[model samples]
Target: MPPKAEYIELKKSIDTLIEEVATVKEQQKTIMALVEQLDQTQADNLEKDKKIAILENRVADLEQYTRINDVIITGLSIKPRSYARAVTPENGGEPAELDVTSTERQVAAFMQSKDIQLDCNNIEACLPLPKRGTNGKPSVVLRFVNRKHKIALLKQGRKLKGTNVYMNDHLTKRNADIARKARELRREKKIQQAWTANCKVFIKLNGTPENTKVLVIRNIEELNEYDV
Candidate 1:
């Protein structure tokens, strides 16, 4: 081959090799940058996953508590009950007598254990007044079922031993009170148009002590005959 021609061919081959090396280096740099970005994204996602797990656990606990507690009413009074005790009490304390038609001590015990309270704010009608017949003498006649039990305990009375009982806005009261007030405002048809304060039920778990929500009813009969 001629020297000039051979030299030209060699120069062309060297230029092609140099261009290939440059292209390889550029590709390597791009790959490294993508790898770093992927690592950062994975770390961010992992952190978000951890936070999501914590939130889910909190939600689960709250849902569990709200499911077990409820409120209901019958006649002119209110009662509360919890399903925590079920049909048995294995504790050493005096066994609670189960009542099928009334809210018994079992409801009280369950509320105490769970730190739940029941308020009668949902009862709207006034206490039944004694009636007089044509004889102008007071006649003793029971007007409501379980009237004797309700009167003796005065569970329907609004005069309670509360610090801010008359206060229009009191949030520190028991959860039941808050719910009852909410219900009252709801029954009066003053939910959205009215300026009703936030009446919410706060719940605390046994050990974790977290606040949650519960629904308020008029009496235990709402759950069952003896749920109060």
Candidate 2:
């Protein structure tokens, strides 16, 4: 070939190579932009997950706070038939319905027997829970005008341990389940002592120097934290 023809062919090849480099650079820029967008989306999702966790914790705290003023008395013997007959007329007439008054009087008498020194006026409400099966005595739920009186009653309840009386905080169903599990753990020798107070389940491990561990259980998912 002639020299002029060779020079023209080389110049055309150089132009094509430059265009290819520019295209590659544009593709690189697009890929980088997509990667940056993905990073931002992941960060936003992480922050949202954190906020959701915080909100869930706050809701649990609020639920527990509502039950702080309530207390439960178990092992209180209640013979529905006897009590029903006691308030009835001797003429074999219709049995008088047992109202909250009768239940309150019974609770007051129990407290007196325990020497708890609680005023009847301080009791805001009293009701008996449904009898469980045949052997379980119906528990009594007591609401006080103030939490202080409830605390006092609970403190004095220690004296009735040897007897058939037991007292505990009135926890919600979720906390109650946790408390039951905690006791089961203790029975299995996994923990030294497990109890509920202020609607929280506490576990004390044997040979541990620290105090009891507070379990913050929300659902079955959270139980994994306690190795449950």
Candidate 3:
């Protein structure tokens, strides 16, 4: 071959080799960044799992206490007791107590201690006083305090059937409902991950939307021969 043509061919080969090396370096940087992002995501997911577990256990404990309270009041046939004191000292009135049981008294005291203002206006009407079900089972009724602050109250709670208390079905049902909500939250997180991954790939590929660099590379063979 002629010396001039031979020299030109060698220069072309050198240029191709340089391009290949630059492409490889770019790919390596992209991969390293992806790995770091994945590690951070995994750590965040672990924290979320811990938080969910704590919330689940707390809800279960609350459900158990609520169901048991219903049983106590129902079996005892205790009416909800209330107290009233006269402001006028000259009248010398007595502190009126109702035919409520020990369990009812404890629950009312607990509610008052929590600063949950009770709507005692229709207390008698809202009964079998928040503890009795017409079908003769205990129920956890959601009642409102001061026109707000909705709370769970028990009714018709009798201990029967080998240490099991007959309460309304909603008690166990609430736990299942909460689990469904958690599943939806996890699904949203998956979508967010996909969106983030796309964003990262776009940033690394860096080109105008009209001429993205990743799209310009047609095949693995072209990428290997690319000029950096």
Q: Best candidate, TM-score-wise? A: 2
Greater TM-score among 1 and 2 belongs to 2
Ranking by TM-score: 2, 3, 1
Report the Cα lDDT for candidate 2: 0.77
Q: Which candidate comes out best when scored by lDDT? A: 2
Off by over 4 Å in 3: 66-68, 72-228
Q: Give the TM-score of each candidate.
A: 0.32, 0.65, 0.35
Over the stretch 85-198, how does candidate 2's per-residue lDDT look in tens digits?
A: 344566477666555447778878877887777787888997789877988777988889999988888888777868878889988776788778777777877767777666
Q: How would you encode candidate 1's per-residue C-alpha lDDT over 83-181 as one tens digit per residue?
A: 333344465564555544334343234334434342333222222223335543221112223323333333332433331212122122233444555
Is candidate 1 or 3 superior in TM-score? 3
Query: What's model 1's TM-score?
Result: 0.32
Residue pairs with backbone overlap in model 3:
131-154, 131-155, 131-156, 138-156
Clash pairs, model 1 backbone:
72-218, 72-219, 73-218, 73-219, 79-219, 80-228, 203-212
Better of 1 and 3 by lDDT: 3
